[model samples]
Target chain A: MAVLEVRGLEVRYPRASAPALRGIDLSLDRERLVVVGANGSGKTTLVRTVLGLVRPSAGWVRFDGRDVRTISGETGVSTNLAEVYRLISLPVRDLVEIVARLKGGDPAELEARLREFELGEVLGRRLFELSTGEQKIVGDLFAVSFGPRLVLLDEPFDNVDFSRRRRFVRLIRELRADLLLNTHELELIAQLDGWRLALMFEGRFLGPFAAADLDRLYLTRGTRADALAVMETSLGTFSVTRDSGDRPVKSATSLNALVESLA
Target chain B: MNLWRPYTKAMLANGSLWFWAFAFMAFWLAVGAFVESSGVGPGRSAVVAYTTSWYAVIVLLSLSMLAVAIANSLTYGSSALAYAFRFSRLTPEGYFGSIVGGSAVMGAALSFVLLGATAGMFGGRFRLLLLPADPAGLLAVSLLGGVFFMALAVTMILLVINYLGLKSTNFTGFLPLVLSITLGNAQIYLALPSWFVYGSPFNDLASLLYQGYAGTPATVELGAASVALTWEYLVVGILVWTAVLGASSLVLLRQIRSRQLEEGRQI
Candidate 1:
């Protein structure tokens, strides 16, 4: 069975005229799924919906075969404490201890996991004191700890240094579970193997393309500037540029295009 | 050791818990000193002690106010409660345990501290009882009465917290706690104010404490059923409040958990 499945999910903010996500359908068993879109293209919203942080105005979220609602039954952490659990910036120790208790992990095993993350010493410190890279490590560690068959990572690389980003890419390789991550960091795409890419525009999730297709998607823009412009307007924007040798480089035309492609 | 590990960890992990415990102890110490110093002499000390006990009453009243605010905040997501949700993994039961346990431990610690201070002030031969304080006798009655009041106070706070929701944070969760404290304090002077007393546990506690404090001789005049001062009363009262707060917190936690799940799924 697919470890995680989402179908026709839609999210609308309280007063917004437009929906955040209109009809997002996706599935994964154990492979890594990277969502690339522009800002506000619904990447984060999609992840949030899957994580059960946002309620869907429409559609269903399923982990394994169970509905997301059933996973959070009568006996569990309430919404009040949910925000606390989402605090990735907390010290590695505190986060692991909390996740250990939440997932009902054996204390010894939790300790082992902490050591594995090279965070045994760091755990004793406050979460806010950790470096940005350390904080991301803690976040990834927690997401991987509970054997969550399907994990949603929203903008996992935001504010992370390139070196740490590479480290996180290595960590992602070591992760033995399925992942659905949202980010615009293309560097990650170059490093991680066996991951599918989902392009997003406005509120739509475009192709779940292969790496070669993504390379072509990057290349074809130069050959078809008019098509790129049309796609950019619908998708948001497109820009053409050149290298030191004056080679035509077709890229994002505006911030909107960049955010949409990243989202 | 592992069994006590959670308690020790709790005490150490959250300095505020220890702070509340010690703060209560200091409060009781002050009350004891005030009572001893105000003595007009000999047998009439009872009257003086009675009046001076009002200091302790104020402390208890403040605690009630705090309880009310805490309950409301817990139910409503007031400041401290909101912080608790953010920093602590406290399930409803955990939250309740922390508050009630901290309160009682502080209350009892303060009681003893006050007693010691009072003895020191008198400078006479003070009878130090090595035996456990009577939990089932007169002291039990007093403590039980206290617990009844505390429970009612806690419930009132919880109800407000639950109903107030996000608005509970406006006053940093102090509003509900203060409101409870004020209302509970007002009850002391109102001679069983019609609204709070008829069906409330505090009514029973008020009569119980009066009887317990007054002793065996006054017991008959105070009521039909007489219970002696025993150590069990303190133990039992502590246990009862612990249980009550715990149960209520659990219920609240479940509600919060479900809401978060809906949120996560929405994510």
Candidate 2:
């Protein structure tokens, strides 16, 4: 049975000419799914919509076959988005305790998990006082500490150090929950082998292929008159663009390089 | 999880809130008491009237400040209410109940402080005004009044966020204080009709506070002539307002759908 489902999801900001997400359809059961996209490509918006933070302009989201709005708190949905910590002035310990109590998890166990991550020193410090890397680490730990049925991580490795990033990869591999992670780092795909991959560009999704095939994927100038960039994947070729221009074809494997070439 | 414990601790830990809640008002109250004591004779009607008026203002100001605090806690970016609603087992009604209950407790505690300060400063000089005629009634009114203001503030904040799409605290933050001073206490300054005075929640709250403190009908100065509001009229007005505001707050809490709050737009 599918644990989470989103159908025809579309989100538009007030006064914005373009939609942030358009016709986004997804279904996740027990498999780990990774969405790779550039900044402003609707990855964060999708995560937030799934968490019920943003209302969809069209369609609906459901968890365990029920509408997301009908369910109360502690529905086993967790995310590592640092925006959740913005403007929160409480100490990390208080935050952990609050979350643990709210989710019906053991506080002592959460504290132990913090210590395991070498984050015991942050217990006394307020969330806003921590560095960006530290905040990401705390957010990541909180998302996984509780026994969540579904976990969503948006750019979890953005500001983290190399050693902590390696540790987080191990943590992701060890997680028992179904995962939906979005990132632009192509190198992470090889590490997370066997996971499903989707490429997001301009509010649409492409290529639900194996993460191992990321090395074979490359972006080049499109042959079609209206297409801006064309993604050649092992599954098929997909193109989504509004601009029509003649530019040098730049073959790139990573999202950053592809975005740079597009720019 | 016990929500009150953490909520109360957070409220108590706010230094600026304490300054506004107790220290700032207490300073003005002490000064008023000292000046009034030196000028007026003991057991004078003028003293009772002055004390009642000052007490009403203090109650209004303190509760308004509390309303703003409660509003911020519920709607600000990364607010506890938002986080709990998203991740915890907390329902809208549960969160609303905890906030109102917490505000009532704080309101009752503050009433004691105000009453204690008034009695200590004036009791030495005026033996007749040693204490309120009904101390328990004053406490009850304070608690109920706190709940009313909190409900009103929360409903208004949520309404603005939902309809106007405005989530900035700078825009809607001081709404309670502004409303309390102008509309909430309009009866004190303007000559309102008998029906208006009896129907308006703000007027009712002011009347209740005045009557509770002085143990008599509250006299509303309407230009040259004044109207005395009876206890029956004030009680009915407050209860009706409380019920209406409470229901409105619950409805608005369940309807809040602003995406800006989660995006960190509140300043």
Candidate 3:
């Protein structure tokens, strides 16, 4: 089952001249999906909309075949006492504690998680006092603790250092939830394995292109092509007979080479 | 101690402003007390009334202004601070609770300092002086007066912000403190109305500072029960202000949460 499915989604900010997003449809199962676009191309808006942070003007979002609205989206590990720990103004340790309680994580397990992220020493510091990078790591840790069915991150690497960025790439790959990340760095995109790629342009989904197809499309051409060209060039040109629909041209260059060329 | 760290940071950051305000009031009160002590008849009486009243108004007014300044600064600076910290762990409720809770603590600390200075300048009497009408009435007046007046000011501020959405560049977070102080001061000067000295908290608090100059005890009388009741009322009023602000905090927190959710931003 698709972990996340956004269908014909549209979002318009109040008093804005145009919609921030115009009909966007995409889906992901347990696979990681990287959403890439230039600034103001609605990448962050799309992620936020999927997470139920921003309401969609039209269309629906579902997580694991359930509408997002009905999902009882409790973010922390343990939702009850979690609210209290969150209330107290503690530092990194406080965050770990909240994560532990909400997620029902073992204290030892949490401390290990904290150590893994290099935040073990800063556990005693307050949230307001940490540097931007440190804080983002903590935030990422918190999101990971939720064990969410679908995880959406907006600019997760903005404040992350290079070392941490590599760690985060590994973390994203390891996250049990289906992942949807909106980011601009193509380098990060190159690091992922088996993730779908969604290219957005002018508030529309340009491609839910398979990695292979996208590689072929980009290699043969400077950029990803429209649906028809993507199918023709990557799959091969084909002619349709009156009696039969379009057929693949099997004798053409290997489809693998087409993808490899694009890669 | 850790709980107080954020509050203390706020105090230290703006410590100079608070000190300046206290110094200004101290100077004004000292000047009045000196004039009265000099035994100039008309001057003494004039200083006794006007100076004492002004002292009450100025102290609360300065405190209120300072409180507003600090809160407004924090609110406007929060966005940059949020980005700087990368601490997205705090829910909107948590973030706002800390800020508001910190402000309240700051207010309480300042109020206590003012109270101590005023009491010390007098004979260490903490209770506000009521013009004895009936012992019971005097006590009732003090208690209800403190509560009614503070709650009124707090409620008004909340209403203004809720309706206005704190977006007005001019008002934002500062107006509540300003309006609370201004109205509070006005009510203090015009006491003994509304069947129970409407602004008596100011009058009572102010009278403490001026009490050192009050050589004559002025036949003040009130029954013991009324006096006790009045003290209870004042305590309760202060508590009510605390409670109302705390309760209303949840509502504001939720409002902010809803707003952020709409924008796809976490608190």
Candidate 4:
């Protein structure tokens, strides 16, 4: 049974010229799903909709067959979205304790887990006092510290140092919860082998292909439609379109190349 | 999470807030005492009336500052940390309750400081001239007034952001504090009708505080004539306003979209 389902989801912000999310359909259970997208591609919007933070203009989102809004308290969904780091006035320790208590987890246990990342010294420091990378690490640590049923991390590697990013990827791989991570870092696809991959462009999703198939995929200029390219993966073939003019496309194997072609 | 302890600790940690809550009122009280000691008034009764009135205004302003601070905590603090509440077992009601509880405790402690200071300062010469007639009543009025102002400020600020489509700026926060202080002291500056004066929660709260401190029914000095405010009128006004504002705040809380708050569209 699907633990999470988002069907025909469309979110249109007030006075927004274009919808933030359009016809997003997803189903996740225990599989690790990685969504790759650029900025303003609606990855955060999709995550917020799933978390019941943003109401959709169309369709519905459900967790365990119940509406997401009604079952949010029971779902144990956690996220590392930047909004979680907005409480700059609070010490990292207070924020962690508050989150742990709210999640019904022991604060001491969560703190002990965060200490594993060498975040112990910064625990007493206010969030605003830390570097951006440190703030992101704190958010990521709390998102996974409680062993939630599902974890949704948006751009978890952004601003993080390469060494910390490597450690974070290792930590994420060890988690038992279903994971839905979205980022523009293409190299992560090879590191997180066996994970499912989806390419998002302007509020739409393109694929759920195997992460391992990324190296085998190819992109070529689209002739039949207004698209960035026609991508061929292990599963099937599809055209990737954007809101703007397309760039010259070549045989693309790396995700970065594909993104550049789309760009 | 233990909301009370954390909220209290967070509030107490703010040194500037402490300065405003204590130092501002202490400064005024010192000036009042100096005036009283200098024998500046016409008679003992006149001096006592002036001192009590001064104390009431100073306390009201102090409470206003505290109330605005609580509202800010509810607005900006919640806006910043809303994601924590959304993903946790803690309900919106629980979070709201904790903030209110923590603020009420702070307000009560401050009231005691004001009361203790007033009694200690005035007890020497005036024989409890400026001390509250009923310390318990004054505390009760402080708690009620503190919560009411917080609710009013929160509702007004949220309405401006959510309905008026205004961004939560420093002006939005300041508007409520200004409006509250003006309305709270309107009777002192303006000679409004008896009904208009007593019907307003701000005036009613002021009257109750005055009554608690002066040991007499609060009299609205309307230029030439005066109207004594009754206990029934003041209590009813406060209760009704608190209930309405509190319910409105809860309704607005339910309608809040975390995305808007995350986007910095709300406080």
Best candidate (score: lDDT): 2
Chain A TM-scores for all candidates read 0.74, 0.85, 0.73, 0.83
TM-scores for all candidates: the values are: 0.67, 0.86, 0.60, 0.86
Candidate 1 lDDT by residue in tens digits, B1-267: 011233324333444533453455456445544553454345543543343333334334434443443333233233323323322244445555554554444344433443344344333322222221222443443334333434555555444444543333345335434543454345444443333333333333333333333332211111345333332343454455545755665565444421222221212
Question: Interface RMSD (Å) of model 1?
Answer: 9.2
In order, the B-chain TM-scores come to 0.47, 0.83, 0.51, 0.83
Q: TM-score-based ranking, best first?
A: 2, 4, 1, 3
Deviation of model 2 at A2, angstroms: 1.3
State candidate 1's DockQ. 0.20
DockQ of each: 0.20, 0.39, 0.10, 0.43
Q: Name the docking class for model 1.
A: incorrect
Runs of candidate 4 exceeding 4 Å displacement? A13-17, A70-72, A85-88, A223-263, B28-40, B74-85, B116-129, B166-169, B189-192, B221-227, B259-267
A138-218 per-residue lDDT for model 1 (tens digits): 555555554444556777777666665666678667867677777765545656677887766667776576633344454
Residue B19 in model 2: shift from native, Å? 0.6
Whichever of 3 and 4 has more TM-score, that candidate is 4
For candidate 4, give the lDDT of residue B46: 59
- Candidate 2 chain A — worst ten consecutive residues by lDDT sum? A242-251
Question: Which wins on TM-score, candidate 2 or candidate 3?
Answer: 2
Q: Native contacts retained per candidate?
A: 0.00, 0.44, 0.00, 0.49
Candidate 3 error regions (>4 Å): A1-5, A14-17, A26-29, A51-56, A59-73, A76-138, A146-149, A159-161, A211-214, A219-263, B1-108, B122-170, B195-252, B257-267
Expressed between 0 and 1, the share of native interface contacts present in candidate 4 is 0.49
Q: What stretches of model 2 exceed 4 Å from their correct place?
A: A85-89, A223-256, A259-263, B34-43, B77-83, B122-129, B167-171, B183-194, B220-228, B259-267
| Backbone atom clashes (below 3 Å) for every candidate | 70, 0, 11, 1
